[model samples]
Target: MEPSPLGSVDKALLTLDALGRAGADGTSLAALSTEVGANKSTLHRTLAALRHRGYAEQSADGTYRLGPAVLGLASAFLAEENLPALLRPALDALSAEVDELVHLGVLAGQEVVYLEKVEPRRAVRVWSAVGRRRPAATTALGRALLAAGPLSAGPLSAGPDGGTPETEAALAAYTAPGTTTDRLRAAVDEARRTGVATETEENEPGIACAAVAVLRAGRPLAAVSITAPVERMTGPARDARISALRELLPTVLPAGLAVPPAP
Candidate 1:
């Protein structure tokens, strides 16, 4: 017999993927042959090999489905994950230490996606669970990362506007009872002034958040945040959050990434 153009292992893998999309009622060999653009004989032999390996199963009615071996691959990947996972252990320990909720988010368009979170053991805590999405303009982490975009002159600076149309629009979104758009603009100004951002009841009432940007190659890759009940997040406590981050920020940075602005 002439050799099959579809290699044994490659052909089996392709057939497995096709069966998943085809679903349980099953599909015909001819249909799979057409879908994979392989001749009938080659495709049949591939499916037989898959059945023997237990990576793909055939139904009583002759349909195909994925097998249990895939779980081993998925489990292995999840075991040694990083960043969101690597940061979680540290964030969790911090949450217990601070009695607050901690989060790590990455900028996504005009919003930020909550990628990792650590919550307090106590019942009373700030909301916004892991995987919760929040608008960038009105949140502390968003403004922190945004403000890291520009440098500041002082605490409450000269102009409320940052000379950019985008900055002004972002500044206009802080309208949550205690927080005004002007204040948010000022807060961003202050973060640029002080190198971090903090907010109280800006997005959610009776909640407070402090965020510091993680810079990479002159860009903010993501932000780290700490959230707590408004009362617990005030005075010296809030100030400490900012102070500690500034001190420790250099440690997390890589060799070339730790450059401070030269006078």
Candidate 2:
């Protein structure tokens, strides 16, 4: 019972993606046609339509690139999405108390999409940004989100690997001291049990974080985390951060976004 794909729309989006990858210099029609696998004429028509809508712009040299219209669309989307605005004040407050970076992220398939980032005054250079994505298994935010439920209907109706050799290789590739599949499984289980997730230098070396989901009726809508240098996150200080997150969740989350009582 699969639905039919919208071929033309797909092609148009692929063309835009190609242009984005091409960077500021833009791409010529010949290159775009080759990348999108379309005839030059059809691609021309598509590009013309996009240009008319202000989604694409042509440079003087006959190359095309993404236009300011894309920014407009993105702005509209973010405003309508509202998650960032909704969480900002709470995240800001949390960052102030902890004197560390606080980020809010949502689960997107196998990754977590960062929506907002609040950096303390003495923040480290974080590798993430607003709209960036990272693997769910490799972060406390991802583990916390997964603790609520899967993004789609599948296994773990009740909930959501550490490593074999294959997994070890994959984990090694992810980062040094990266998460193994088995370790990831263990983290998910722990989050389910405790309603919090923690990680040390998994994504970026020297960074550690503790996170918890903001749930809506037992499903995770998003997650929030406090991140700091590994040395700063330890003993009573780390415990205090976890305690603060648990205490703030009820007050920070709006009415509709309720965290179901722990089982």
Candidate 3:
């Protein structure tokens, strides 16, 4: 048998649960007492304790309701979650449906760091690994993230002195020999207009990719990309691959995460 819960803790939790069910209007002290099956005096003490800890609030009309602390705790829990672990199932299903390599990445300064990857059964695969970082300007994943709002200088920041333009210049110095700042800026703009980003051999030779941002509260929390050989990703086939990502990715995303709507 499970150990019995402590009386004080149990009472507090039961009161909280009751308040939650009571909704935004809150509940009267008498009603809460009846629901918890405790005497008015004991229930009052419990309510007082809950209020002291910020777990419950009393309205001007003397009704009790859930408090801001509950939301704070929820936000803290979400912040501590591991992104790769939370989204693995979705990544796996997407790779299976598209039969191509899928990558999950986050922006780190001007680069995108790969957090998770799912590979298909084909012998030919994109050369990528977890923890590897790539230029945000040259890769589809980074461009998708950049396209979503809330960059340090704002999305596709065009200020001459800083933001995307400055980052583009810095990226150009060390990126693949042929990649140019103008081309990278254009890719980001395209992503903003089209709601997806694409790269052709910009990150690696013979590789092509398409990506979409995973958004939270209107900001890009991460990005997902489908990578394949250049031949398989060009012409009409490229359109099909991109369509697959837009169509299939949303189906497997967990609650609280979403892809931008098609433009």
Task: Return the TM-score for each candidate structure.
Answer: 0.55, 0.58, 0.70
| TM-score between candidate 2 and the true structure | 0.58
4-27: candidate 2 lDDT, tens digit per residue: 298789889999999889988999
Ranking by lDDT: 3, 2, 1
Arrange candidates by TM-score, highest first: which order?
Answer: 3, 2, 1
Root-mean-square deviation of every model: 13.7, 15.1, 5.9
- Between candidates 1 and 3, name the one with more favorable TM-score: 3
Which digits, one per residue and each the tens of the lDDT, describe model 3 over residues 9-48? 8888889999989999999999999998888899999999
Itemize residue pairs with steric clashes in candidate 1: none
Each model's lDDT: 0.66, 0.77, 0.81
Better of 1 and 2 by lDDT: 2
Q: Model 3 reaches what TM-score against the true structure?
A: 0.70
Model 2 CA lDDT for position 59: 97
**Model 2 misplaced stretches (Cα beyond 4 Å):** 1-80, 151-178, 259-263
Superior by lDDT: candidate 2 or candidate 3: 3
lDDT for 28 (candidate 1): 83
